[model samples]
Target: MIALHCDGSLTADRASYGGLIRDATGAAILAYVGKGEENSVLGMELMAILRGIMLCIQNDLRRVSIRSDSKLAVDILNGEVGCPWAMQVLKGRIISLCEQLHSKEIRHVWREMNQAADFIAAIDTGDGESIFNPSEFPLELVELIQNDADCKAYFRTSSF
Candidate 1:
């Protein structure tokens, strides 16, 4: 099984999405960051999921465990909530890709648990997408990915 962690965020006028793909042993396979085709947050989230599924399919990975920080996206895909009209087409495509997989599991994780993907998603990637091998990752990104692979916990603080 392959484990995919993905995230999406709005930056200025554009939305960016990114994530890392890991094997069952938690070793990084590759990392991706890209600008969204649409500016909607949900659109970006769904797009990230779509990209992850496509990556798995292209690599001939049959069992996928997708983790995202978007609860709404996860809920919608899992049939726990209705998909918005604007997202029906994208959602359908995602479902179709999922059907091609021998096993697919989509789950929501807290942002803290998804720091690496969140950080990658916020990167300004201009107009195109970028994919990186583990050896080519930026220092900060490499650190984040390592921490994730090591199962290190990340804590976030918010002022109320």
Candidate 2:
């Protein structure tokens, strides 16, 4: 079981990505990537989330606690909002997928708490961050984020 979370931020069109990955043991990993382009940030943000979910599916992961920063995206996945026009075709597909995956289990995290995920948006627009297991990151990288709140803060303040 794992509690997987991701966050994304977008400009008018450019989007950034970041994520938190935790295993059953509670150890975690952080990743960030971004896509710079002239697409709606909302689109990019939701794409980031889709990317994360696809990873979990590809790995045969179960008991996942997926999360995201975009309320619109979250609501859409959670069946809270009516399907948008463009989503009409996708609505059936999306809802069917949600049902297949038990997507209601997904949650929302605050933007500030989603800094790592936001950083990911800068990594690979639609491509997203490579799906890495939480156990993959070295203790040094984890410690760096744990010790340096300033460095973590830099992700927000720096130009992506």
Candidate 3:
């Protein structure tokens, strides 16, 4: 099974999404961080899931499980709740992608458990886009990745 963990970050004038895809053994397959043009946090979260789904399709992955910190996104994808009108288009696209996959699972996870992807999304890459294989991860992200693998909690603080 392939496990995809995804997250999104939105600030006053910018939004970004990120995801980490791993194989059944917990080895990283690929990680992606991309900026979203959308202004809504939920929109960014849905876009992140969309990107992760595309990655799975590109890699020919059939058995996939997607986890995210956005309960709204997961609930919408799972048909547990109606998505907002603004998100209907993205919701449709995600549903289409899932139809093509042999098997898929989407679930919500706690923020602490999802820090790696959140860290990736929060990064201020000059161009706001990056894709990394396990060996190609930036030096700064190595420790974050390791902490994620070790299931360590990452706490965030805001500047006053």
User: In candidate 3, which residue pairs get closer than 3 Å at backbone N, Cα or C atoms, i.e. clash?
Assistant: none
Query: In candidate 1, which residue pairs get closer than 3 Å at backbone N, Cα or C atoms, i.e. clash?
Result: none
List residue ranges in candidate 2 displaced over 4 A: 16-18, 29-38, 88-94, 100-104, 124-160
- Which candidate achieves the best TM-score against the true structure? 1
> Each model's number of backbone clashes?
0, 19, 0
Q: Which sections of candidate 1 miss by over 4 Å? A: 156-160
TM-score of 3: 0.88
How far does residue 156 in candidate 1 sit from its true spot (Å)? 5.1
Model 3 ranges off by over 4 Å: 126-128, 151-160
Model 3: residue 56 alpha-carbon error in angstroms: 0.8
Query: Roughly what TM-score does model 1 have, to 2 decimal places?
Result: 0.93
lDDT of 2 by residue, 35-117 (tens): 53325555555655555555666566645777777778778777798656664544454345554464337678777655445
What lDDT tens digits, residue by residue, belong to model 1 across residues 1-160? Answer: 8888989888678788888888988888888889887778899999888998888888898899999999999999999999989999999999999999999899999987788888878888688898878888788987887787788966678798
Ranking by lDDT: 1, 3, 2
TM-scores for all candidates? 0.93, 0.64, 0.88
lDDT of each candidate versus the true structure = 0.87, 0.56, 0.87
